[model samples]
Target: MVMEDMELERLSAAMDGELDDEKLPRLLGGCRHDPALQESWYAFHVIGETLRDPQLPPVRLHSRIAQALKEEPTVLVPKSSVGSVPLDGATQRRWLAMAAAIAVVVLTTALLRPSLPANPVIAQNGQSTPASTENGVSDRDIQTFVALHRQGSPLSEFQTVDYTPQTIAQR
Candidate 1:
């Protein structure tokens, strides 16, 4: 894969007369039989022509672009930081250090924030009885009342576990 990428890079460089004289002949020889490389070469030429003449309408090279993407090698290539304002090594390092410090501070704050004590108002309110229970809607209290009601009346065979008027009426 690396070799393929190198070949493509060399081919691109060769178009601009950047390849060494020793390797130029061999590179040209491979292009003669390589249909994929031939397509790439033609596409590069078309790009150069379009760039040189801004008045010319850009041609759609969808097939060539798709072929290039399909044949692309998964190699990490360092790109030149041209055209934009370039930063010095020291400035870049300082920015990276600042980013790392900010990340550490954020992570530390997140991890420790949960362990802090709850708000006093929330703590007091959470312990208080809910509004429904204040209106005497208690499960245990209802069960006790039902037990007393059951003692005064015997359950009938037609009655279910649920206490209903049908059970008392049958008795």
Candidate 2:
């Protein structure tokens, strides 16, 4: 195995024309019997061909290299034969359902934004108004609302219960 590896390395170096001139003839002579060396020599030539042609897909070149080296393929994942697995239909559906649920929640929040109150403010006429009113909310209204909020329970407490004139706490 070690000898084969050494020969393969020497074959690669020779293809690159980097081997000593004295070693090249002996290496070529061994190529006839040593199939591994021949394979390495062929791989180096294929690599050279792949490099020279800019259009060849790199994956094909990689596959060729792996085949020539007789190593487990580093590129091109083999299709699932037995042990290899993919997402089950149920798993895919569950993920899609989750994504759809999230989208629905986001859309609901965005659509409901204009109707929801920014701050709970009991107006002068004893009507509850959102602080984000398009008609424009007065600064005094905001101040009074903030003061009322500071004095009262959290805003959620008033959401289920109706507010009365007494809720305003007159300035």
Candidate 3:
């Protein structure tokens, strides 16, 4: 068994073109007498050839596959019941009840939904006021708020200051 394994290893190395020249003659001699070694050599050559050219397959592979498929038993599947199955009286009534409940919920939601105002109201100082109206904030009020915000904001400190050669001479 060990000798057979060593022979297989040497045969594999030879197939890879890595075996010593001296051992090549002895390996070839063994392959002549040993049917298993001969099979291994043929298998290795076939594998190498297949790897070199993937488009071709073993000679009898297609025929063997066709024979295997022919020998296989045919499978018959039953038709699916799904929507074709008839529901019992109780089940039919339950389905009808569920459908009616869904319809009622949909209708109730559509009828009870609140209508939205044409113009959205803006809230200021806890009071709801229509924007761009007499009671709402005016342009002057907006400008005053913007000025106050700029004065109070920390970003106001980083404002760009104008510089001149006279200012630099003073510094």
Candidate 4:
């Protein structure tokens, strides 16, 4: 694959007078028999001609990007600092507290609901009874939530997962 890439690179570069005498024939020979490569060479020439003329119609960036993405561009954004991705100590403690409280409410409701019979009277106080949580949303969601929070924040060393469908309890 690398040899093929280098051959193509050399052929393209030869057109720009970038390749030396030793490489010219090999590049030419490789490009001559490859119909797809030859078409690429011709298209490159046409693009060059358009660039030199400058009066050619403007290319839509979105179309060009769509085509390039189909061809698989190699660009990738580098990850930032890796440390400090987890919530700070105080914030984690607070989250633990809220989770604990929510769990307590749910447990209390579970215990209290048993005695209320099949048609338990509705509480009209407008306060919600905590329901069973999430059918056990994966640990992965927690990781992603933290990652997304980091992504939205200015924390340079924080960025990772993405997630959905859960909220931290306040009480």
Candidate 1 residues 90-132, lDDT tens each? Answer: 6667557546644554455345334332433121323532321
| Per-residue C-alpha lDDT of model 4 across residues 1-171, encoded as one tens digit per residue | 687687668656755656775565555555545655655555554454334322233222222222223233223334564553655786556547556644554455345444323443222244322221121112233334454455456863223222321232121
Maximum-lDDT candidate? 3
Rank by TM-score (best first): 3, 1, 2, 4
Q: Is candidate 3 or 4 superior in TM-score?
A: 3
lDDT of 2 by residue, 5-39 (tens): 88887777776557665676677668745655655
TM-scores for every predicted model: 0.30, 0.30, 0.30, 0.29
How large an RMSD does model 1 have?
A: 32.6
lDDT of each: 0.46, 0.46, 0.47, 0.42
Q: 53 in model 4: Cα distance from truth in Å?
A: 5.5
TM-score of 2: 0.30
lDDT of 4 at 27: 53
Task: Give the candidates in order of lDDT, highest first.
Answer: 3, 2, 1, 4
Instruction: Indicate the worst ten consecutive residues by lDDT in candidate 2.
Output: 65-74
Error of 3 at 131 (Å): 87
In candidate 2, which residue ranges exceed 4 Å CA deviation?
53-171
Q: In model 1, what are the clashing residue pairs, if there are any?
A: none
> Which segments of candidate 1 are over 4 A away from where they belong?
53-171
Clashes of 2: 0
